[model samples]
Target: MAPNQDEETLESLLEASKTPEGRSRLAASGAVATTLRHLSASSPLTLPYLRLLRNLCAGEISSQDSFIDLSGPDTLASILLSSAASVEVLRAGIQVLGNVGLAGEVHRAAVWVRFFPDGFLRLARVREREVCDPLCMVIDTCCSGVGGRQRLEELCGTDSGLRILQEIIETALKAGYREEWLEWLLFKACVEEQRFLSLFLTLSSSEESSTNLDISLTSVFKPELLTTQHAFLLDILSKCLTERPKEVTVSGKFALEILEILKMIYNIVDFTTRVNAAIPTGSPAIDLFGCSLLILRDICAWEDARPTETDKDSLVNLLLDEGLLDFVLSRLEELEPPAIVRKSMVKEDNLFPVELEKRVCPYKGYRRDLISVIGNLLHRRKRVQDKVREKQAIPLLLQQCVVDEENPYLREWGLLAVRNLLEGNEDNQKEVAELELKEPITPPEISGLGLKVEVDEATKRAKLVNISG
Candidate 1:
């Protein structure tokens, strides 16, 4: 056939695959499948043929029959595995398998294993730049599909499969593919998918398997890998701490589990320490209770909908805990200074240096000093609907703004901060009013000589004279 005729046939097949009627015709007739197989196997497969194959596999073709006679599974796999095909062709083939959900078909799966049993493992090791969206789609489909988990488990069980995955992980690490998407996939496989976790735990439990996994993870932590994966690892660790309550036992060993994971993923002790410290403190039982609340809060907040009553109650309880509350208050206070000082310095460096230098200053002065920072935090808290905590946080913050005689300029700021906090709470407003019971000073009157007179004394003297009269 002429190249133009072949192109036209390919386009027609693509169009047919896109609609239900056409798809049914293609799948039922098997003509499309025959054409696809022939075109795919042809030497120097043209781009048009490759596109048609992709469209067919991508489920653009509605017909299941279109897939039936498109070469035997083994033939299709062999064509894909052949060194003659380009990476684009291989990717198109994998995508077709994924989109068609053919991984569930035993015959197709057997062909897949026979021809490219290690294909995913190979793709996993490819350079980050080369690991395109189609590859990710293929991995996601296969790992999440029927028999995919079992296949992964089987592969992990084998020395060769394990070796291949290990190498791929190492390559991914080295090539700087530690973004959230990749980490999320790994997290899903390790935590969400029972088989993967089971296999991982089983392997890590054994001295030999543990050694190999460790070596693989270690190889993945080369400097470039560490740099790329650090934030993602931290994110994963935080999520694990928040979400994987079942995995974390109440015993100190759970903390150890976290530490172990952190050590394996990254070498940042400080980051791990911060996360560990963030874990609520109390008796293991109470700690578990509090952590559970935190976890619930995190999960509810993550979802699109509002949290249920149970979630709200848990968050409230967590927020109201004196120790936890105090910690949050302390953080608010700690965060208040740099903002005040930075702004104050920015506004008038020389005059504000004294207040800024002090390690402990009143919150009132701090606000005056760092209005921008406090405003920003308040904005964030408000955006997140933590108004109650934000209200509670203000007083503790204001106390830090108090100024002494040595730094009198801070007194006005201290008072202002107090006023701002008081304004937010009715009880605080009343308390503030009672604290400043003295009447506000009135302006003095101008005498006939055009000089101001002391109003308080003059009024008092006039009242006394009138009484005497």
Candidate 2:
């Protein structure tokens, strides 16, 4: 049969294998062995066909005899090992073997590890354009425990398996692949199954240079990819913090991960610097939306503790340099409450708590540091003025400040920054004055200025007026 016909047959078998009756029929019949034999042949098989057959053999077949009868389970394993199929097919085959749910088959999972040294590494070497989506799907599905937990254990135990996973991470750092995909794969391997947490720990411990991460870092800053991946990386890190907290220690590794994520956001302001960037100017609004959400999430994440001056400066420079201050401001404005006085909104239990808010609330020094960042950006020379339109920039930032003021500390900072802006520039000052004159001005009394001033001024005036009269 042609590879396409084989693929169709495999698909039919897989669909049929979904039911117990179908699975039993597959186990009882010779169809699976025939497919395995065909897969083992020198002739090329479509990736989908190989994947489906692998899945069906592992999942539907219950008896060791079914696999063992194909010249023994070892023979079937040899076919899988030698085929050197695409990562998707290999992963599918491994998963099927795992799904057999027989402890005796654990050795087959181990065989995959022994046979495919750096499976992920080889996959990574392939041009991402050629393999990224398929490889990603392979990682995604394989890590899903589609085969079973024992199978995962078998794979993880293999040195090659661990290396492959590490390669995936390294590739993610270098290739600038989608963080969501990486996160999904990692989460499945480490968090959901707990099979690859040790591998993550080992990789995190290894003294790999940041150079590997630089390409992806640079790519992410590109306007189009930046927003989407930035949000994705943030979500991934946040989930890691919550789900696999133990694997992610409070070491430099964790800090590095956080910093990498922050760099992506910081890079957004200058996304046009590279020659062949992923995110170009005039990208869709969805990109902006993703980028904005990521920034907000990061702000919320670090809202509590005081960031070191170095961290603060780096972040500010990135935001100011990239022209992201306007984007940040815009998000704040969008979150503002309606002017109508309505019932007080109560917090819903189902809603995830904003971890950033809680972290920021207690740290006065941190709040000051954040305020300084906003102030500095408000004053800095615009780097991409032509692209961003300076005339439209300050108002957008001011709107963010106004809207963000719902948090008392953020509100205070926003008001003070606005004050600095309105008072700092002659034009802004005039604008403020004009606006003030148009509206009623209610000034809060300056604290500690004595009522004695009012009394003494009145007495002195009375004395002078009486004498004059």
TM-score of each: 0.48, 0.39
User: lDDT (0-100) at residue 380 of candidate 2?
Assistant: 30
Evaluated at residue 153, the lDDT of candidate 2 is 59
TM-score of 1: 0.48
Per-residue lDDT value at 382 in model 2: 29
lDDT string, candidate 1, 1-469, tens digits: 2434655666777777676566556556554455454665555654455555555555543422345344444555666556566666665665555565543455345444553446666555455533434444444455555667776565545555554444444455466543334444445444344223233333333224443432433444333333322333334434654665445322222222322343343232221111122222212222222232333223223222223445333433333332323333343454323333343343443422334323332222222333322322222122222443345553344333433332335435444434334433444444333423433211111111122212122222101011111
lDDT by residue (276-314, candidate 2, tens digit) is: 222212332223333333333333232222334444445
Q: List ranges where model 2 is wrong by over 4 Å.
A: 1-18, 44-52, 58-112, 127-181, 187-399, 402-469
Q: Score residue 365 of candidate 1 by CA lDDT.
A: 26
- Cα deviation at 191, candidate 2, in Å, is 8.9
